[model samples]
Target: MASDMESDIALHLKADYFDFFDLSIEKIIGSGSTGDVVLAVHNTYPDINRAVKRFSLKEEDLQKRNISLERVKKLFYHEVEMVRDLDHPNIVRRSNGIVCPGYLAIAMDYCPLGTLVDHLKKMTSERIDKFFPGVVAGVEYLHSLRIVHGDIKLQNIFINADNEAVLGDFGVSFKMPENVQGVKSVGSTMGYFAPEVLKKKPSVDPFKCDSYAVGVVLRCLVKRRRPGYTSDYMEEIRSTKMEDKFRYFLERLLCRDPCKRSTMSEVQRSLIEFTPDRYTLELSRKRCLEDISNSSMPQQKKPTHKRSASSSS
Candidate 1:
């Protein structure tokens, strides 16, 4: 019965979509925004393992206007153009994609290691420091392409099996135009947003927003707590208000003025020269590995939230 169901799904999927990575639908590893499914596929006629993303255009209610179908089409085109144009090792490589009836998907390289958010939640500072360079490099590469990731939270960044950081989730990226009006409410986590975003101030810069998010992630590594939100420690950081080193870094990134924040290039330089405190790296690594191993074993599906169309840029 299971085999029959799998075969049915295979029949529905288009050949052009499946041929790029050379795998069937049954090998799906995960799914993302808008039922975007990622499959662990084989290369060279079952020689090697690769990952592919397929976009499904099934409407919840075909009787309705089917706005979801339109969104899927737009997103598919946007992702293909963006990913094809971008050439960064830290960014997931797009092998190919196909737009077929009820099925549209892209092929990408699979990363066995999971999201950085999950990894960071479990690890200490030391382990994070050792692996932080990859993140910096990835961000630098994005900047080189004149793109602002807009969303730089931990969930969008993944760690590979080799512990290298790979940036993903480019659903809200933007290239700066010379005469651009400011973006209002780009999708971003509350605790991770910069002051400019929170205040909804005009003249906000997209690059600075990315910088603020990076600072938030860095603070998570050093403090083991999400900053900007109202926690006891966060309150303490707020009260100190730029006195503490970590808080200072956060403030610098989260500065209301875009011109004040450090650029991705500067961030890369800092990560390379950084010397972490003793024993922090090993402890963080152990904790992260343990947490991920335990959590990934029995994955529970969470309710999906509707993301706002607003650009964090």
Candidate 2:
């Protein structure tokens, strides 16, 4: 009887593979080292769109890769497991997944407006301010769960259909091998990594590292440009005439010592106490646009926010 039950379970798992085939790809959304994300719709719910991430490994690529397939599989499942357990308004939700020979696909909510990176390129400080609280709230929620989002850059932040900033790519830390004894170089982005990570400290605090990245992300949003390295932008920020409190906030985030950095809770408190209002948001946008128009940086012809479907025109 036990043997028969085990066989039944195995068959059920085998049958699950068919679910991935039901997704019809609309277009390629994004691609990275691990796989490609496609805008797709499930056959059962053709009216609604979903983002399907498919992992495919070719023979030549697999043979030339340094990491083993076993390691990659472990990491991928770790991400799925982590995402499956999270329930937050600001975090992107994963719906389902499927696995087959040499391929794996996971479906998640589709963000139609693209990533914060795309918006930041043209958005002014006012527009960035609108999204700032949502970003911090999302990160604060993650830290509350004791899960560190290894990568938290503008590119990983998506704009939902409701015009809210929703954080995605929140589980890249699973890429690390479970048994690694020393500081493993997971190739975190340069400017976003905390100093301890850069030093390859044996036990770098992932939480602190994430907070540091949030600081960089916040700075990039305000500056409306990529903050390449801490050293590269620290001096520039210091020289710029920003509000004292905001400048101090960014400085504390960029603190080299992890212990000196601000906690997400503390950052949230500061935001609530000193949050900029809509008037300030508009004022800042105007000032920033004037500066850009007078400077050498390429200015957008007209950077306008798209009206949300639910909002009055």
Candidate 3:
């Protein structure tokens, strides 16, 4: 049966997600995230597009650890199962999973605007108010599904052409069962991990860990400044008795005690009410666009027209 399944997948090598949905694949608008092998594949049949994530546990680090191939396969399968059960607009929609000989991959919705990290790098303080609510909404939606998005960072949040934010990259996500203990080093990035995780505390809640990461992301976006280790700026976050609205929100998210931090729902509510003035929004957008335009991506060439008189020969 496994052999037959492999043969079936082989037949659909270049098939797009829409093909399974009874649609076509032809209008892919953009592509990014080469590290994870993410691509924007469009469905020409239905005039739609989606993101495709190809999973391959071929990392040198894992291979060096001498982990069993079967164990890696099990981890991939677990991610697929978790993604299949999730349903939320803020979260990228998982369309389907396909297994080919020695590989596995999943299809999901695409966002053309770009990554939140990229967007934040270009923007000023003024534009954050308009752009951040969508991010908060996405996080809130994920929590509603009872799934802890173990890696909630700027890179994983995508922005659509319409400026809507969608959460992506569930490579480290899992559902929380009641009375469950924490997972160790599941999918955390250095410097962004919660204090409890760094200390390896017992009974650490995955949901709280996610909140802490979210706080870091929010700070990075709002401040437009990257706080390095040993920087006095971190003191503002570490010492949290202040009453500034943004500061308060950050304090709650980065709270030492998980029980004292704000819930995803509460974070979403606060974001909605914390609107910035219009001038700030416009200025930030302008600055962000300029920065993006100056980045390494090549500038598109202008089109030119030519006469066809030479064809008479």
Candidate 4:
């Protein structure tokens, strides 16, 4: 599989004396806790555009923040190694890892259509069905490796050029301990956390927490509303009008009890078994293109702004 992927992908960069000067940085698309994500294209492979997350820090600053520079570097390398090797269509592909002087960066394919959140404004009822399977497949891939995505929410799910959902920002993702009972929760955002996680219980099923989050993400996909607190969002979901079967399935996902909550595999199976209208998939693509076209005209260049993140898009 790796060799096959290599055959298809021409540019496979390594962490070495990669010529930093060769990268033509167009703009800084985003800023995260580690560093800035600059949109760039390498001189050799301009066709392969990338979002480069560059990490640069000083020992003095780390001292002030009471953080260990070595620890930070260790985690950065871990993330690079973890993401760079993974091969999944529903997950963002890591194109390169650079370890040049005063630079530690990971480059991924740039998704021009923006995140799933960007399309929520026009997300029709059936479009969520269109995206759900892909999202489930991505999450399933991570869990199959026993990798727990501690943070899975709106901002983390990026949309590719084909208008498909791909999971990114794996800074907090970790391999689940052999003890299937639970794993210590690491990085997270507030609104999507499950009740057990919100309470900070010592032992909790990480996958359930993620499944609950997936439910929240799918709900937000069409609702175009960011959730508040877990309890509040639960109430909102209860009242929100959706298909009876979907609502029932969501009930399984959002169930407070981790034991009773649906696993991602179960959810995937259910989706595959039931199957939504095939036409809805095409309709979703059509609508996405229409939305992009309508917004593309009268191109207005917006100023780049730095925003803190646990990881890059």
Candidate 5:
């Protein structure tokens, strides 16, 4: 809610965040490269649930990473402070933070439905379309504050009890430098890398990079598959059977030329004017079932030649 993103916040002070809450060891909800998240309950508010993430780093881990304990602490609090200060409906809320001897812990709103990755099997055109706006709103809010999410992916997007998409994981986030057009560093997520990033260009626009990642995340959810590393996914989008508006929207986001890429503002504006066509997986499945039921052709006979074979060779 604060327009000034750089304003100092008092949330990340070292304290016993868990002293007032109870963690359910049995309910370990999430595990990732940095740490594991478990379900937590406030001591006074027994009915409410939260996700407590405990970041882990041992002596060798620190040595291998070439980072000091103080540096790790600063980075951990950096993420916590960003999430704690942000007040947006589509962004996950952080409540508390604590630093221990070797690791740190933070508590946040618990989205019972889990993340987008958990619902890959249930994702459809409608579901993907429904959450598209929330992602945009969250990113829009971040950009409004001059902050970049740095990482946006299915695993980082959570679905709450209300089934609304909310963004999480600000560990890799950074504030866009004042008056600066672009930054030299970015998050290390490969599939979500923008054209400028993939090309290993020195200076990359953080805002455009985030927009590119949003497109990839949307594509993976709608397709119910992992984001691919191919550079020509736009061609695949064109060849696929989807609404014209929807197809064009994706093409613009995935455009190889940064100058021609669609910004989040443009995307939000387009959505306001038109609602794209919804997808129907049942129709596709039914057609496939009908073809199989009507034909006796063996699967192996469909293709006769080896893809790698060359007569001249």
Candidate 6:
């Protein structure tokens, strides 16, 4: 599989890079220090709407950045390469990629509904039941291939045109080498990092780290906000009145010891057998309706500042 993927990437690299002139940029949907995300459509494929992510100046002045753009190129290439091989419905689909002089861009299906976080803010138990299966299936597939998704936050989980949860963003993902306990170090986001990772311990299990993040993601989905990376979050979880099925599952996922944490397969199995409690579903639905009502209200106008007459004179 590895050799086959290498050959495939080679072929893809040789293929014509997407022509920037042919793509019409609609608007800037998101931007950050790493890069900017634009909504664009290819003139040749007008019917297709894509979210194009541009990694600017990633290929310039390698020594200053410490890591060469060659390495950066591999990261994007690896993501594209992995996407090409995996055909699961829950994994975000990649359309095309271009490596121009100063930047690299990859196009993917434009998710109009937004991310999992957006949906979770007004979450319902039905939504969790509906989306959780697909997400677990996607993660299970990655684990089956020994690919550790180093980042597993809600932002990386997108809602597709079908309203299904599709996991995206493989910037921190890596294939685990056989016989290795874990990687020495890796990048992560706050609140999502496992205890071992937070402590900067040697030989941290990347896969287990993913489970820890997923546990946090699930908590956020229930609370409509990311949990603080402190004992307070755990205290809240303990005190919160939740269904036994869910509480039990979360207990396994949120265990402080990575060894005690449930594997992706175990999570998948639990989700299969477990049904969401009715009381929880009702509470979720109530919150969703409240969110709708709040959003429907008109925003009040801000008072305008008046210029002083002295300044005019």
The TM-score that candidate 3 achieves is 0.67
lDDT of 4 by residue, 80-161 (tens): 6568768898899765656555656777899887877778788876777667788889999998988878889888888888
Residue-by-residue lDDT tens digits, candidate 3, 121-227:
67755556555666677777777777888888777877866677678777678887666656664446765677777777755777777877777777777666553
Off by over 4 Å in 1: 1-16, 19-22, 25-29, 43-47, 61-67, 179-182, 225-248, 275-313
Give me the overall lDDT of model 6: 0.73
Q: After superposition, how far is residue 237 of candidate 5 from its true place, in Å?
A: 1.0
Steric collisions counted per model:
10, 0, 5, 0, 0, 0
Error of 6 at 79 (Å): 3.1
Q: Residue-wise lDDT of candidate 2 within 140-197, one digit each (tens)?
A: 8887766667888888889998888998864475423445433443336777877777
lDDT per residue for candidate 5 within 206-278, as digits (tens), equals 8888988888887787677888876457877877787666676788888888788888888888876555432
Candidate lDDT scores, in order, read: 0.63, 0.70, 0.63, 0.74, 0.76, 0.73
Give all candidate RMSDs, comma-separated.
18.1, 13.5, 18.3, 16.6, 13.1, 16.9
Give candidate 3 misplaced runs (Cα > 4 Å): 2-36, 40-48, 57-68, 181-187, 225-244, 275-313
In angstroms, the error of model 3 at 235 is: 0.9
Off by over 4 Å in 5: 1-16, 42-46, 57-68, 100-102, 276-313
Top lDDT model: 5
* Candidate 1 per-residue lDDT over residues 204-302, each given as its tens digit: 667767777777777677655555572123444476433244554556655556677888787676544344543477678888997886687546533
Best by TM-score: 5
* lDDT digits (tens) for residues 231-265 of candidate 6: 22556679988766667777877888889998889
